[model samples]
Target: MASPQPLNGATPKPKPITPSEISAEFSHHDPTIARINNGSFGCCPSTIIAAQQNHQLYFLEQPDNFYFNILKPSILKTRQIIKTLINADHVEEISIVDNATTAAAIVLQHTTWSFFSTLFQPGDAAIMLHYAYGAVKKSVQAYITRAGGHVIEVHLPFPLKSNSEIIVEFRKALQMGKANGRKIRLAVIDHITSMPSVIIPVKELVQMCRDEGVGRIFIDAAHAIGNVNIDVKDIGADFYTSNLHKWFFCPPSAAFLYCKMSDELSDLHHPVVSHEYGNGLAMESAWIGTRDYSPQLVVPEAMEFVSRFEGGIEGIMRRNHKKVVEMADMLAEAWGTELGTPPDMCSSMAMVGMPACLGIKSDADALKLRTHLRVCFGVEVPIYYRAPVEGEIDPITGYARISHQVYNTVEDYYRFREAVNKLVKDGVNCTLLPLCEGYAQLLQMLLKSSLPVLCISYCSAVDV
Candidate 1:
């Protein structure tokens, strides 16, 4: 979404958001709905949004100075801050991209095709888990296919019982690839999955890749930053990318890519070549043509704002993790369904199973359910449909992924629970349920109406 131009020709300094003022902090959101989908696009505080507006106004005020002189310095400063935040070795290795997908694409597209051919030949394989994001997967497949390489998809079952299971499955895939005379070239793994919302032990996975002769590893940490503690140097991944908008409280279109400073990567180029064509990774990425630099500029302010919370960013992460667990447990128990991953394996987001009978056959059907939850029931959460894996028996499932941020309350989850339960019982038609009945009643009666309106109407309606 394009940022709206500032109103009244000036940006106001709004108060910083605090934990207690969670819901009130974000006035841009639809108040009637409980926003449990922060994992998709993060909720930006009004203060940060105002700061972005100010930066925009400043850019237009002196376009020449801002673009030629001030912009580079400001961007460099933000890179240094991000370097310290993610524990990168140097700012020069970091490039500000629009999002993680773009970052991954730059790495794949900029590298000399000859080098990729040497690393991954026609029969050789590049590995990615089945749970990898669609965009990341497509980029890898396209690049690898063009280079005459095949993909080895490591299948990971949802509702997994243990983290060790992931390690075992990965090792098996590596052995299978070796047996087929397929040398594993590059492996793409997520720090936290987008759909199931499970936190993979990336540090361990990186070591396993090294031991198994996987040439390079790309850590897709899109949902990892504010949710999981990060130490990029310690993780020792060849490449890492994460979205500031998702968790670090920055506006959309702001994310950073970190490449291990190496002589080999000195020739890397930005995807969009411009006047700064051959100026190395950092410079090339900085001048990817004229666009909104506000998202990248106000990153420091977002970091400072998050640090001002109760125990700072650490406290916020802890609170969010706890809230997600609480919500996941409540909904799982209500639906008599299992969790997508174990409790300890999840961070700020968790996926709880839904009845497969929801009849969510396509993406459109899944989206309709999500919309019904939002528009009719005033509940905003992500709904996913996981098709049955080849080896599983009737294991097909639907899932509700809930995200918890500082600007969220348990009351929001309760509202979500009430709404979802009602939807399920009405056979996903959503036409039979009172739609706004429970939503309105919750406002009038709050927790007091939980038994009659929420429990009986939604929870108890499901079979034990």
Candidate 2:
């Protein structure tokens, strides 16, 4: 594979990179920053971004023609591709939405007391993992409360030893609910947990829910679309939602919601009851008023671009998973701590335990650490509160999660490693850290500091 060169000569091109060098192919990210936070909001590949831009331009050129004639077919094609990628039973079962959050909201609103009377009623219990995304938890709480139900938190361990442990915890929750005489109606589980970056056994979880007599299951697969192989039907979740912007390599506001195609969901509609709403699941989601549909239009292109990498889709997934494990291992050894998750339980993202020396106290401290890394070190990674909601409390505040994408290299993790090492060894007081010190003085301080630093030089003057 010949390395892709800049059209201009000023930018010297490295030799054609193998599949590992795929990061060089994406031009949208800031060249100066080592972006290791792809799990939060995915970075779109160059080709897919271009495809979206072209579609937007086309829409602007002829609004009536594009919306009335072109948009429906384009959306249908994208949904079809997504359906096949996830092994969904039917194309119509998938509905394009702005994001996983929206997809989840739609499901919650329709299934709760607001829409369905038989499903979620007063005093019904909705089950969820303690590791569920806060936003989705809030969504579930809102509808369940309105319907006069409460949420049952199934506490899954962070440093999980085995998948059987998760099943045991869930079984306990089910038994407790049963003893209380409360009906366990719904469960909102994760395909990949956001904070800890653990790969959940969705298939086993779904089966467990079924055996426990849970009426419906919703799988929040926000980080699973591109990072993990999705078999939606095989998982047997009644509802599933994923974001294309995160792992599917699509533009913002690109996501889909899938509902099992059966008599159970024959009348469910999109959250937004618009004029274009129809009786069918896909038809109602097709026209959610006028909005940018370009992202939805480019799903196939994103799939093609990633698939064209040296090893194709399977290859891309394998490389990312391996890279993240390698990255996690290095970081863990450097910090003298274990990788929070086992290699087999992790996909393209891994969360490593932070050093206890840094005394991170609050969410503010975590944010400061993240910002300091970005501003002073030019490394972008997520530092979060891994403090679990239940069970034993952790002594440290949280772990820092690294997301490995096709557009990343080992060099990026190296940059992050160096930065973390400096922070732990030197202990910069984030509370009083100065931003934008005089360039010359900054250089002098960098030279005088006891800890060796990687200095990036740039000049700017503040007004007297």
Candidate 3:
């Protein structure tokens, strides 16, 4: 076979989207502004929007017939698309959920933590990173504490040098957990860290979890799906959940949970709604109540849309990651900050550490930076405080994570830098501005209204 050529007909370039093109795309959706915080909730393509609308229309056209005859078949079609995209053997092992958080919570709810109560006896250890999503950390901790299990929090090094360095540090943390005589029952690992965008070596970490005789390995891959080429089977995790709404361009309520097939762990229960009392398929866990499953059904269209524009999943991954690297370089130069992770360790997102202002302590400072960038300049990105923690301190001090997707442009980051510099030069007290008025209100409303559109638009833009 001849070697495949580039999909875009040339080497993929990391150029910003032109303002005219942005206007044209937003014109289709009737939105007056471009959204830069796609990492928070991705924008769907127009195709997925049409698919969703078609499904809803069908339901309204014949409510009972659509629910009874059409819905299951549509979902099965969606499963086939998901299976091909993720390279799964059986489509039955995948179940759609609202988001990654709900998927993880459902898995947690079904597990019999008491089975490992003796192994993870009181003071027996569980380990999690400081950078893990606060909600996920809290969920895991709650489960362990109820079973009288101890929690050993590990602080991952900020501004990591390479992928291997992160793997080594994670291994060391596991060793520490074992040495403390708390047989690790479960470890919550992130395929991509929420704030830093660090792509951890999940395969190696899962194998290590198995070696430690851990009962389960739960992955919170909130930012993984469309941002990377994910083969859940290759990762060898016991349980995995990821947000299609965030990365895969599916509409809101589009996400999936995967459980490795085994007779020992076959039957699982839904988190809240339990229509299926006893079933082995993954869908049995989340498809309990009567609600619109249209978002989940539209996933195939979203995937197809992405493949049509960017060639295929691999092509899209390469382009998105390249854009993230390019944006990080441009921002670092413009802001005098440094990139935290090397190219290999980074995915389609990057974190740049900013200098802290005098007397600006805690996360409030981070909020100020976020506000200044969004209200003053229209750039939306996440700003977070990296406090001093054991084994990681200095360079990790103050940082903001910038995420890049297909819809983002280089000009967005440049505008963000200009706004922050202006605020610093003026010695402006960001908080002094009336918290209740003007640009702030506009920003708040824009973000609120954009959520559904963003979710729908992601699938439409990407097609898968």
Candidate 4:
């Protein structure tokens, strides 16, 4: 298979999306030409995109003065905007990074693990959920194992009955760790798990960590920032990080790492080779050498753009959340499956577990869902299988995670339901193989249409 062409060069002519054509309840302003499977990366409003372009132009005009005098101050201002958006008391504690993964890695690398070593020793404990992002889980495993630390895996059941059930089960796991007489060095909690799209009770869990006398709390809020209201101080965790790109409509590589103020927790480092190794804030972590600082600088504009819409940020949250729940209910009814999480635990996204009769054994089945929906129906969502290491795997059970952003409409969900009904009624073995082959052609078409304009112009295939 050939690689898809890039969309960067010879920028497409600007197309204006008017306010009246947009949904009154949501804030997104873009033409729905392609189905969006990648809301995890986020889509910026035209206003924010314009602001980013302006900044890029400015930097191109003069690079040096912008780096020293302008860039740092601009970023600090961006932090102030974040502070107001998230209701933080002070912006000093917040440091911007590329994304949540980078933020989590920095917190793990910089913190004093010796304190944890004294408590956990060589074989003692750390705890995490099964649905934690694969990257974060690997980072923690690498850090702990190198330091002779043990990690306890906590299995979170799908189709949980309630938030209390999740909390109680997690608490019981922590108690089990305590019973083993292994000091709990850290608890990595997800503000929202990616696959299931369930919001964990971070405030309750962090307090539990404190009561358990754990060393620290690290939160992965990759999907949390724009989907729900977040106040890091209220969360009461030692460390937290979230990607603004996922939910906040900020450009890619925009995220924040927040650390609680403490004289003892002063040592932190940037991930790459940099001059500010010793200096705490400006020199060490902040510089990180030269790259595009436009994304970080334009964060405030993204915040402002969201604010201008009818529902504002909170309004967008409520609107998208309601839409996804409705969509989930409809899809569940169509597929004869149950919702994965309760309404409260569900946010702007939800997961529907595939019924026992639908055989989704391998990656082929997963790609079938991705391809069939995109080509046949123009709908895009993710489907995959997950099981606890100790739990029984149902050969036929899998899940399709549906994400509803502002651009998504009720018609999109209806189309998805119809497609699934057709596929499930037909035998999986007979239906899936042809679907996958057809999907290859669909991908080719999308790639051709998505080819960068520069390539099209140079080739002059038909019309330039």
Candidate 5:
């Protein structure tokens, strides 16, 4: 029931949402922890969780009735619901997979299967951005490499100067492939990147592929579903995949893959083969190992949950975008760090720089700091480290990927801010966070009890 609103147009100010209003919608979220990492694994609302429980209980009660009757129709009903969210031409073109990774494998395996009119010829190349998800890159290597092809990476700059820079870099990659006497058979583009989260100009890039004579296009949109307004048909890619669990408030692992109807997709099949081997993508993907189908079964309720907001899904998206930008600014100013990406290039997530005093020199250091935050401060957020890219000589630095959801409030960021300030005052370095489990537990207990004096005494007396 989405209206015909412009996906990327400016929005009027969204109505302010209070914490109690958020609690009414998502009271299921744990109130103790400061959860600002919704981009990683989404927190499901209480109503959707209850609905999922009902589906699971129904399946456990009568397997045959649930599988034979509720399963197939429920899956198709989800396809119908999501078809409008992305503006797909037909529900038949959509297939619900476990997640974005599985969807990538399904398309990659089909494209590389040694059959009639294979997409990857010998010495062919597939174009991908340097910011592509690590697992998806491996899938390309597994399938495309086995087919005697190579991967061409578009080295887009970090802290992007402009969208034009991305478009220019993409053209260079396509030309580089052609210059090497290789046919660029496939182009994998991310609708929004994972670690250093930034929105890509997928529509322009898709058209650029057509102009560059690329064979096929796959949009890896793991973080695009609920955060951004999508018009998949307008983007015009051969295939697109987005994870519902990331931003759409589905349970654990539900995602949709859209394949444009064409002769090339005639041999497309799910990675897992079952009774419906020769069936289309939808039927084949329906019965993959008989797993819990709650995630996919609850799609209608999830859609309904978002529709209750003031502007429906679009309104929620605008609200989240506004909140994230504001928080990022506050953090950057407090910590004396810059924002990694601009507001226009972000959706519900933005990369805020970590204070340099944390002394994070690698991903390992970043992980240790994040662990300390979790154990001591009861804050859960993602911190990513990006060393200098290809041509840049910048030093390796850490960035906190802050995400905004309906349940989040200003206090969440304030908690994180005070926690870091305490660590800095306590002289705790990222590389030197307390590794002793007993020590961490003691500090955590003291912090939870609101006895910072005791925690400080413990910190000062404890020797690493």
Candidate 6:
């Protein structure tokens, strides 16, 4: 075990990093930044990225050959690996998609009938945690409303005290829906929440949905796949989706959607109804009009690469959980703020409350402060605004989402900590205070310049 090669000018601190975990494996990552934001859009290993590139080139070299002969097998193989990885009942239950958002759209679209009958009769309800991913939440609202249904949000306390607390809140939502005569037609649960990262008690939530007689259950496990051990069948959700690009160390925008293999899903389909409309979800998703399918193609290499570590993917996850919890707690202690989540409730990512002295009162402030951290200090952690609770009107605005991957070390967290400390000491006003100073001036100049899109894209697209 040794330290990874020093990134930028930072010296490698001795740790238990193996040769396979060296920086060369992650050469695509920016060497200048302390990229602790793996949960946002996962960073892929160079080897796996190379594998995808080769697959892309192979597709380009012979378009008809790749599409007609080569594509389905690669997709099927990736789905097969995912089926085994998540303990799905059958390979056909898994369909590879672009990301969790697309997977969500597919599920939500089919949840309602287009013409004669609907999954929701007039006032039926679709239940989801208030913490559901924003895009997924929007999709639920849009699709369910079309079916003459409505959305019911199950609001639970943040910095949740125990799994029991979540169970109680969800149960209340079910009962309230029932009492109000709004049949709980659908339930969406997060296997792991995005903003304030926590390992949701998904099994319990799924069982609760079943017992409550919810029509169909969808586990939005977008951040789950490589982040935790999943037994999809055991969870018993009708629909489940997880993103390989987010945590499985795969390239951008690859994920798996799992539907329970039964007569109930005979009409399930990929949202984009192309030439394969009448076919099953697998066939329909397989031929989505000839874009780069390289990410899904190289998933085998991504999963295989996990073997280079000591105990395989599960072992890597265990080590990552330990490291992230330790680092998050360190940030909380050093910043004089508390952790939003307890240790057991968290997985490889956790939310650490940022110091209040930074004047981050709104999400806008959080966004600018986030940019300030990137430009002035070269730190790349996601700064988030936590949701409110019953009593507190103004909850904490900013929490640093720290993620731990095999490529990351304690030194990265150290870099983030030092940057925040410097900001606090220097009185960098988050609002109008210091957007004119130092590197921020350069960031603003780039934004205002006719340099086209990079600067504005950097600010908005990179945030979440």
lDDT (tens digit, per residue) of candidate 5 on 1-464: 96566578866444554567669767666777899999988879888899999999999999999989989999999999889889998998899999999999987887687422563568788889989999998999888887787888888777775689899999988999888567888899999999788899999999999998888899999999999988989999999999999889899999999999887566789888888888888888888777798989899998778766778879889989999999999998988788888899989999998877778878877887887787667789988886755674444388999999988889999999888777767776677664456766776666556444344422553211
Instruction: Return the top candidate by TM-score.
Output: 5
Q: What tens digits encode model 3's per-residue C-alpha lDDT throughout 1-464?
A: 97677888996533443546544543454232335567887777656778899999998999899867887787777767777767777777777677788877766664435435343367666677767887888887777677677676666777788767767777888888888465776778998988867898889888888887877788888888888888988998877778888877777868777777766456565666566656654546435667777888887677656655535656667887888788777767766778888887778778876654322345765676566456545667787676666684344466667776666666677766665566555554433433344546665565556443221211221100
Q: Score residue 171 of candidate 3 by CA lDDT.
A: 81
TM-score of 6: 0.88
Deviating ranges (above 4 Å) for candidate 3: 1-34, 112-124, 357-360, 388-396, 429-439, 442-464
Best lDDT among the predictions, by candidate number = 5
lDDT of 6 by residue, 397-420 (tens): 578889999889788999999887
Give me the displacement of residue 340 in model 2, in angstroms: 0.6
> Estimated TM-score per prediction?
0.85, 0.86, 0.83, 0.83, 0.89, 0.88
- Badly placed stretches (over 4 Å) of model 2 are 1-24, 114-120, 388-396, 429-464
lDDT of 1 by residue, 300-365 (tens): 788778766767788889988988898899988877777888889889999888766565555555
> Better model by TM-score, 2 or 3?
2
Predicted structure 1: lDDT? 0.79
Comparing 4 with 5 on TM-score, the higher-scoring candidate is 5
